[model samples]
Target: MAVLAIDIGGTKCAVALTDASGDILTSEVAPTPSGGDAETLWRALWSLIETTVGAEPVDGVGVGCGGPMTWPDGVVAPLNMPGWRDGFPVVARLRERFPGVPVRIHNDAIALAAAEHWKGAGQGVDDMIGMVVSTGVGGGLILGGRLINGGTGNAGHIGHIVVDPAGPPCGCGGNGCLEAVARGPALAAWAVEQGWVPGTPAAGPVNPELSEREAAALYRENARATGRQLATDAAAGDQIAVAAMNRAGWALGLAIASATHLCDVDLVTIGGGLSQSGPLLFEPLEETLRTHARMGFSSRVRVVPAALGQEAGLIGAAALIVGGDRYWSP
Candidate 1:
């Protein structure tokens, strides 16, 4: 079967058409519309869908939406998306658009897990955790060869798992959540507070001419850049940036250790924008994981970067329809 896959993220929306083998036939992405309001976002997605599916036949639609959503119905109130906090009827709208087809929706991270389990890093692994540590940290779990969905289909929401009781407040209105302490924005904000400037020179003033207000604006801009350059600087031996990355990895390691203790998943496949930082982030993460994962089983779990890269979400979305319940949907 050919499936239409939709990946709705905080900053962008992507659409892809995939064949039964989970190969993307066509795909396209667009920035989430300004304001990110329901109508605007929906229109943007629809346009992308149309563009991706042009002259092609599709049997079903699968959507990967950011969470804090109501499942079975697919009502979303994604925390990072202010315009959607009131909830958007995602599955309902998709069903309305494609009647009589099997339209399925899952959290974006969960969808990525499905993709990884099917054709990416988690292939042949009976139990694993798939994590995306980008603008936020999100995760999905596969245990006993089945996707583990809690009653509300939010089972593998590792991001909100509290790693530190005294850590920063998360957008989910909780303290010390992994997303709040280890994600890109959180790391960048912490680095700025620690005197790291965006365009800091190796051996010169961070910024000589910029006033306090200008510096703050620059921080905002740098924070908006998603901590990628910070990773680069850290790799280049910038102390402040290295500190920030270390903090992020340490926090994540704590969470992963706890998760390993509870579920004992043997593999963690890390994806998303920040995971691209490679060893600069992974070194600290592995070091911390080694320290915290004291139990024999827990210590055995290995963390690795995702193999599918950015297309994991799109492929996972398509897998929702193509792979069916055993391999994809919860």
Candidate 2:
């Protein structure tokens, strides 16, 4: 029997079947429908789940969804997802759909963290922060070899950490949040405001000749095109793009430094579209972190790109069941 894993994000949703060891056996991905109602979104995800699972029996089901949700129960209202702003009873819906199996849901970022800790970059590390810096910035905390759920299951959400009190307003209605400053879309928007022209590729409409899977992949790439273009331009000596990347990196470092001090974490694994900017981002982050994280215990902290890449969320979702003792309690 395999565990069913679901990863839901603002840009895409994925479903996978994985064995007890967390190795994916089969998977499917779809671009999350835009301008849809809550039910519409759920229907799309449900379609994927049903198609992926087919007649396969599963021992458990795990989900990683964009957060600001009521954990354990999984009533989510992801900040980036307007359709779900009114909240969706994800866990209840899944339980009804899959009856009899253990169903679990958690913040998508936390799921990625669990994956990194279980088999990726943070594999042997006992304390770490796993973060995603794409459409949004979110994270999960692992301390003393186990995941921390905090009081509201929102622990380790570093996206809203204030990096600049006077910076741009965030979707969360706060000013200068790390998410507002460093997330891919936010960073690209900032660069545009600063006169940096993003040379995003003309992905246009999905080619009619392409397979369904290829079309979905293209749609996902188009969603993050501007940010990816920014990285490319920065690499080619575009000063404005470089400045934008540096700005994002600095904010990330500042927030990570504060997190390191509070959590006493020794490692941070950063994933998502922006982290792909390579040294253009990490170099500035390292500089800012070193400057601010001067406390003796925080000085040795290491921040590196996540090793599991795009599959981190799926793997982590699987961990909620396979590695339940450490990553899941409710």
Candidate 3:
């Protein structure tokens, strides 16, 4: 049976039609309207659901969204998306659209984790870490063949982990949380602070409003920061592009060290746009993780990129509808 899948993220809304095999047959993308109210966001999603269905029938709906949500209830309050206070009832709205069909929602990071563990770089490992390094950094943990969805469905708040204490303040009211220091905005902001921004060289004045990619490009032509060069080829300079990423590289190393020390995981699968930076990101991540990790064979942990690509969520969501009690938080 085919399932309808929806992935709501910081930049855009992505919906697709997929089969049990996790193959996407059709998909669509649209900018998230800025209404800052749950009702308005609901209306926008409702409209998308209508356009997505277009008279075509599907078995069920599976959704993925940013975390700090109340699960089994489908209520979500994402960080980047304002106006979705009190958690949008995505399940209720989806059910409203498809009567008699069940709907399930998950943290996007967890869903991506689910996707990787089931059919990607984690194919052979029973314990693994699944991460998405896109506009922001999000991650999920799978242990002993089960995905860990913490109380209130907020287990994988990886991005919010404390990376730098003196760098910047995060939205979570913490100073130097990983998201604030390592996300796209921080990266761009750091570029401006460092005077590496486009039209604003180290010797020249700074461009306060310049984009991260532009700054990265300018820095690349004039600088030899291999890390920045990798970023330019990776995300094409997205918000999750440069500064946010070096932070991510270092933070991920520390995170893996802690996570591995705690759970003894043997494999790590990284996805999302930031992972696209290739070795520039991983080389540093691996080095740092090995250096600081608690004593053990953590150095043996094999870190690889995810293989499911965009279909990871759809396939993972479908897995939940068919076996949610076994795979995801129910």
- For residues 1-330, write the lDDT of model 2, one tens digit per residue: 699999998889999999999999999999999988999999999999999999999899989998789988999998778899999999999899879989998999999999999999998999999998887898999999999998888888899999999998988888999998888878788888887755422222347787766765665555443778778778867688889899998999999999999999999999988888789999999999999999899999999999997788899999998996799975
Q: Give the Å error, residue 267, model 1.
A: 0.2
Report the C-alpha lDDT of model 3 over 167-263, residue by residue, as the tens digit: 5877778877766755555555665555433332332223557676676466556643333433662344433334445556787787777777777
Predictions in order: lDDT: 0.84, 0.88, 0.71
TM-score of each: 0.90, 0.89, 0.80
Error of 2 at 1 (Å): 3.5
Q: List the residue pairs that clash in candidate 3.
A: 36-83, 182-244, 184-239, 187-243
TM-score of candidate 1 relative to the true fold: 0.90
Tens-place lDDT digits, model 1, residues 169-211: 9988889998999888888889889987654444233477976
Clashing pairs in 1: none
What TM-score would you give candidate 2 relative to the actual structure?
Answer: 0.89
Clashing pairs in 2: none
Count of residue pairs whose backbone atoms collide, per candidate: 0, 0, 4
User: Which predicted model would earn the best lDDT?
Assistant: 2
RMSD of 2: 6.3
Best-to-worst order by TM-score is 1, 2, 3
